[model samples]
Target: MSVSNEPTLKPERPFFSSGPTAKFPGWSLDKLKTESLGRSHRSKIGKARLKYAIDLSRELLGVPDDYLVGILPASDTGALECAMWTMLGPQPATVAAWESFGNVWIQDAVKQLKLKNLTALDADYGEIPDLASIPQDNDVVFTWNGTTSGARIPNTDWLESGRSGVTINDATSAIFAQEMDWPKLDATTYSWQKVMGSEAQHGMLILSPKAIERIESYDPDWPLPKLFRLKKGGKINQGIFEGATINTPSLLATEDYIAALEWAKSIGGRQAMFERANENARILEAWIEATPWISNMVSDPAKRTNTGVCMVFGGDWYESLSDEDKAGVPKKIVSMLEERGVGYDFNGYRDAPPSLRIWCGGTVDAEDVKRLLPWIEWAFEEVKASHAN
Candidate 1:
């Protein structure tokens, strides 16, 4: 019997989803086939590769020498939970929530941990709550970039330099894509799927000297989960900060992380990556200005994110359309682009206001973004055409 011939499925152009964003420019399936399979993470070879990856992260991000870098289980959520459960109880806490992820942390602190004396300062998606209102006496938690909202904190200037409280930063979408003032931060967490474009399930946890000191000197009275425990008797277990991950990790994932780091370095490191993201943002900014119905979700240009540039339909763009038309607009636009093979996941987050989120990260080429702009126009035209029918 003869089998019928058929073509396998493939994406023509890349998807520009906010995260689990884009892979390295030249990535291919063959790279994975050559990776070591069934290798123990504890093996000397595996440890070396892991160590090298951590070291490269430090060098590329310009993390201080005294800081500790470790690969954590899960993604940014795991890293943030570990810090909150382990290190937050020693002092009063203030959490600033401007977007979905920031609100998640606030929920963890208030509901999950049930910490009293916690102040939750929140703002709408496009704006930050007053930074001046944050208490200097309490440990502060905030995102450097609000990926879902497209708003970002301009810098660490709002933070008090000599404050006794530690600043924990959830920089999942900000790292490598924007400038981070590490000196003002105590503990910072990021995921592999963001700027680096590696697979998810891995997080990078960086602890400053002050953060390490807090872990070593301050004992939170809360019961610590094994996964969240980072210290004993006010001292960070050095092993956990080194190769001692709380749970077993995928060696294959670790190798991919290493490769991503190497790719980041070869592309002129952090500055180059920043430039790439910023350039992408500029391209979108130009288009947004020209488009009548579209506008950025972020109110302040100073705080607009280069990585995740979210846009909302202007005025009554939604209200003006019929209910069916409105409901189908975002879906149709995303589907049309995906079908055309020009862009993939550009849909705004469900929790966010109806909008489109384009990921303009380092791994995404500017030329691809330029190509994507025309497709976005075409997508809206298709949507309009459908509405007219």
Candidate 2:
């Protein structure tokens, strides 16, 4: 525990990247079903496997009976783009962003889509956007959880129950770990690489009847890409929701997602995953509270996320360092931790303020988090000592 010495105890499972996060507990490649691997995606077995994966998602996430849940190419970003490009132009649009991924949505709305009547609501890092201020009857776009900032919307109660506009939410980091008001959400997107801890490249998109109506009724003046085309002959393509993907998909990744979903079901479904993530986050947040030199970047418990908990230097000595030196402290601590084999990829997002982001998603073991804390404290102490001298 000395400042100059590394912690003897290290986390056994410390692969904590925010996305493509640690896999489900007891996960192994050999556990995946191989029957669907080499078959044509359109064939009977391939379609059956894909449909089964979608069915599992619908059941575990508690999607509405009428909602269409399907897999999309290009991970969460592409899925969000599919929703935004197809459904946004019919009404006045509004986009809210507080972190990196959310900002990408804003840019797409303003710079890419070129929506004439658009309202962009933004908040500083470590803060949540004001959802209460969203204009009524405007197609709203936002992320349920700000992955980079470690801030998340506390609830969806602010969304008008009877609003006319479609609400497109990037729930890439919020899916299984958060309780979403499914009825109020129109077009919601998440990634397998996130909460499910599955392979990357594929994203899940959920669409309500309202969102479907938007796609079926409105056509943007801009030319639609083949992948973004949700409508065929001015009617919603029901096939896509039924395991018909726009492009070829990785069957291996599909099996991996199916395995993760099965594991979730085995462990008491979404509630258990939520609890696991909450407990993991609580461990790290509690450490921040007890440790004098560091603090949660989000500051407020209500606004903070249960995944990707961001940390900031809060000690008096850290405050006294030059801005340049202060910026390097987190990197130094992260590098130290990596070198010690206690953690990896815990550094903050490139665009985010110099900080560390520890993934505490459902897949991350709570015991690993508890063991990782002392090592983090040790790293911070060593970094602070180096800066002090």
Candidate 3:
């Protein structure tokens, strides 16, 4: 892909797109360039920085003292898979699937892991499955926020407090954008790209004391790959959850993660990040209310996501247009915005309804969202004008 020489069409406010969302406020490529490069990850200096990054994350997120945070391979997907394959089994499990990612976990549990006594509770993209009836004795897996569908569980109080089963939460897009009740969760996973505004290779896995206990005691009769091994003969591997990663991580990416953390801290930490996301979402909410054709995918106001704000067109806007023209609307709108260099990746997930998924995470400011909304309207108009016969 060749770089464009055309002058950038700066947005009046800012731009938003769901994942690999906007860069951290005031982030610069030069900052990444200046970071120490070509350092051995296991060396004392590298380890110290890596440990600092983990400690900083714990402090910023208000993670419990007993929980262990580890940097894993790939992104949130890898982190979730690691948790599923490692800790699940030897007991009946229940999966709550309301979105693409949660469904992926359901498939993994029933088909890949071959867990026979599993129950899958699901709903369409917009709402959560009824949690009131799930057995309290079975392990539960759910995504705290549905990045693809823009629906999120507003609270963790749904889980029975004294239940023996565990709760594994995929909180990739939820961590910084919303308040997470750490005490209510057992194993939580997130990615740097979603809320941290970093590269997508690193996954953060935090295991609570209860989660560690499960790993230490449960001896499931499943073969374990090196990547999925968290315990050895009922003994939890404490070192892996520390600075020691399963495989070598990109030192540069690690440095970038640290830089992103520093940037988060500089902006008044998690509360400030939450405020930024809420403010951006409010801007979009106002836009959605006034716009006749568009509305949020998540119907419930409280369940709506602050990050990954997805909007679907109303009524027969699609039926009115010819198939060829209708098929091209989303692509045309996305391309127009991209050509203007105002936003990227506003297109919805392939599996989702024909909608636009905008990023309202902390990395993006409200001003950017305000600017991008007008361009979105302009793009729709331009596309309609060109496509109209």
Candidate 4:
């Protein structure tokens, strides 16, 4: 492999990990000045700050008035457990496990909760199960986008409009980056650390009226953990949906989320955010089309996710290597990128095939992605030259 010239351009900000993604374009510690620190979250000003976050999120994301949006103690996982424990026992379950995150939900539904009636729909990395097979008669749980594999459901057309069952969506990496069909979703969960590029340690749970009605009317036989409780005295905890969180939240994170929401609103809200994300992805797509040595991990364009843009090494020379050596290529490429401070945490998820998983969320500028492309080729050539047999 002939090495290319060393690249001089680099992304202005190299914080591209999917979780704890890049913050708004000009974020700094000064942005936390408005944070309500040293005060109880139960205090008047504290609750107001929390409410501000929820209100801004609802407004910026175009959440309907009929739905309830709230902050939860755990990151996306905690909010998911709250939904499963509160709403799943009475309904027969159908889970779609396409990638690591979806598989986690399936494991929770089958092993952790020990549900008696379960139907699992599965697919390998970079693919999705047959979503049409999901029955409306039973609860269906799935991730909108497989963060690790970079696969996503193309749309919500498979969901029946007036179904009896509930739809639980883990949209941690999808929200903000993609347009959500709220009418098709009963329960949606995400963390601040994802698309919004805020700090973690908290989750956001959005429940449709039907989801609230389901949990308020029915109770699961299993004892709910303190973290998973959504009902009290045979009624839904309305306070939780109104900024009264289940546990204490990080004030700094709350303020940071609010700042991100403000930034989203400044840039024309959700629509603008979606366009920016898509534009960043387009930059990568153009690069992938031109580059012969790499290809998208997702073969199907429709199911591909824009944010977690995953790619694999290709070409005859690479394929001739043993599986072990093929796996080592991504590590070397990632190490080269990080060593040069051109990108960080660009390695694929552990459970997925070895590849580069670059974050292309709205917070990331398209120009930066353009700057990063040449460096990827430079890193690949450096690694290939060193590994020449």
Candidate 5:
């Protein structure tokens, strides 16, 4: 059947960027707790707010009582770096990467920190590496979900229960949307901007007791940047995990995050977010299965991510294009969809092969995602028609 160039209905809320994603259903400026703003983060009220964010994050994510959650700088990248630069030296390490952000960690291990006893296993955009092949005896670093590639580890069973090494995960896009085996993750990092749909550029670091021990016991030979330092006088600095940050923080962003967390609580916390994300992705997955010209970037449904759902062109129209033309097809589709006001910022990562990545995180409504699918088909048909002439 020929798809209409114009979709009858557009997404009610056309805000689906993977990061800094769609806000909670009832979000507004007044929802933020503004009392903490315009005050020094070191003040009693400010520290209390920060501590509250930490505590609430723990409550919602179901982090263990022993685990320490801290607000860090530079979004997820900063949080992961603080964990890496502090704990990675003097241990045989394994880094598994399949997407854009994970590759950055591989570069840090090889070129920056220059770990001699490191094993780096990586795959193409939509594929995952052999998780079973990774030696659990060594320090393991990987992303829980590949936001750009839309591939995620199906479960944490592969991580050894009794392991000598620590497990560090960059779970930026997966934390609230997926089930996290917290006990298995010695060090995990995430940002509020992804699933929670809060403002961007802030990160949360969750550290297990084992991770703290690693910090206290081992010290890197090279001098750590001030922002990366998590220790003081050969002891793990407890204050950092408390409200006392190494640098000043944006209290406004913290307020925004707090509002999002409160909204999360009102809506039944982590499980609610997980269910919404699952339903949103399921809606898109159904559309992909029924549509002739569109297909998921990640083939295996179990391994595919429920948050950032990446898709690529398929069928005769896409297959017939030249290599250069095929590279631009997804971009054209995204641009046309945006022009029609049906979707925005749904383009795939620059480094990944041409595709579209829709944010199907909890903050996005299932109905909006369903509405966006027809618009995607309309955009594709419009692009194909233009190219033919």
Candidate 6:
């Protein structure tokens, strides 16, 4: 069946970028303006707000009680770096990297930290390494979901329950939206901007009791920047975990995050959020299954990510294009959708292969995602018609 160039239905809200994603369904500037602005973050009110964010984040994500959950400077990168610099040097490390963000961690471990006893397990995009192959005695670092590649570990069965080494996970796009195996994760980091759909620049770092012990016991030989320091005088800084952030934070962003957390609570918390994300992905999956012109980037259905649904064009139209033209097709399709005000930033990551990555996080409504699918088909047909001789 030929798709129409004119799609009657449009997404009710077209803000679908994977990062700095669509805010909570009823978000407004008023929700953010309630922040205690024009006051020091060190003040009682400011600290209380920060602490609220921390406490709410812990509650929403179901973090363990003994874990040290804190708001860190910068985004998810800062939180990962804070963990890496503080805890990685003492043990032989193994870094598993499949897509863009995970590769960055591997690079930092090998080139920047110049660790000698590091093993980097690399996989192609849309594929995952064998989690079972990682040594139990080695510190393991990996991304919980490869946002760009749209591949995620299906479960935590591969993780050793009584493992000796710590497992640090970069879960920026997976937290809240996905069920995490908290017991298997020693350190996990995420930005407020991804799953929660809050403003950027603030990261939530969740550390298990084991991770805290590593921080208090070991210090990196290389001098850590103030941003990466998690300890003071050979002890883990207890104050940072209690809302005393190492650097000044955006009060406005904090308020935005709190509003999001409240919205999350009103919607029944993590399980509800996870169901929303999965439902959104299911909408797109049904469309992909029926549509001959498109297919998911992930080869394994079980490994596919529910949040960032990356898809590539198929059939003769895509096959006829040269390598350079094929690389640009996804962009052309994105431009057509954007020109119609149907979608924004629907294009895949710059480093990933040509495809469209639709954000299917908790904040996105499944009906909106369903509405967007017909537009995608419409845009693809239009782009394909133009490219044909």
Q: Could you tell me every candidate's TM-score relative to the true structure? A: 0.93, 0.97, 0.94, 0.98, 0.97, 0.98
Q: Report the C-alpha lDDT of model 5 over 313-354, residue by residue, as the tens digit.
A: 888878999989998888887887787788899998998888
For model 2, residues 1-389, the per-residue Cα lDDT tens digits are 24556668778787899988999989988999998888999989898888999999999999999999988999999999999998888789899999998999999988989999999999988998778888779889999999999999988777889899889999999889998799899999998999899999998899999888888888898888999988888898888889988888999999999999999999999999999999999888888888888788897789999988988877678888889998998888788888878898999999998899999999999989998887877777777677656
Kindly list the per-residue Cα lDDT of model 6 for residues 1-389, writing each as its tens digit. Answer: 34465878888899889998999998889767564898899999999999999999889888899999999998999999888888898889999999999999999999999988999998998899998888898999999999899999999887889788999999999998888899989999999999999999999889999999988888678999998888888888888999999999999889999999999999999999999999999988888999998889998999999999899878987888898989888898788788889999989999998899999999999888988887877777777777763
Predicted candidate 1: what Cα RMSD to the true structure? 5.2
Kindly provide the TM-score of model 6 when superposed on the true structure, using C-alpha atoms: 0.98
Candidate 3 colliding pairs: 13-368, 13-371, 14-368
TM-score of 5: 0.97
Better of 3 and 4 by TM-score: 4
The regions of model 1 sitting more than 4 angstroms off are 1-12, 31-36, 232-234, 315-317, 322-327
- The count of backbone overlaps in candidate 2 is 0
Q: After superposition, how far is residue 233 of candidate 2 from its true place, in Å?
A: 2.1
- Clashing residue pairs in candidate 1 (N, C-alpha, C atoms within 3 angstroms): 15-344, 216-234, 216-235
**lDDT per model, in order?**
0.82, 0.89, 0.82, 0.89, 0.90, 0.90
Q: Output the lDDT of residue 231, model 5.
A: 83
Candidate 3: minimum summed lDDT over ten consecutive residues — where?
A: 1-10
- Over 174-232, each residue of candidate 4 has an lDDT whose tens digit, in order, gives 99999899988999999999999998989999999999999889878888888888888
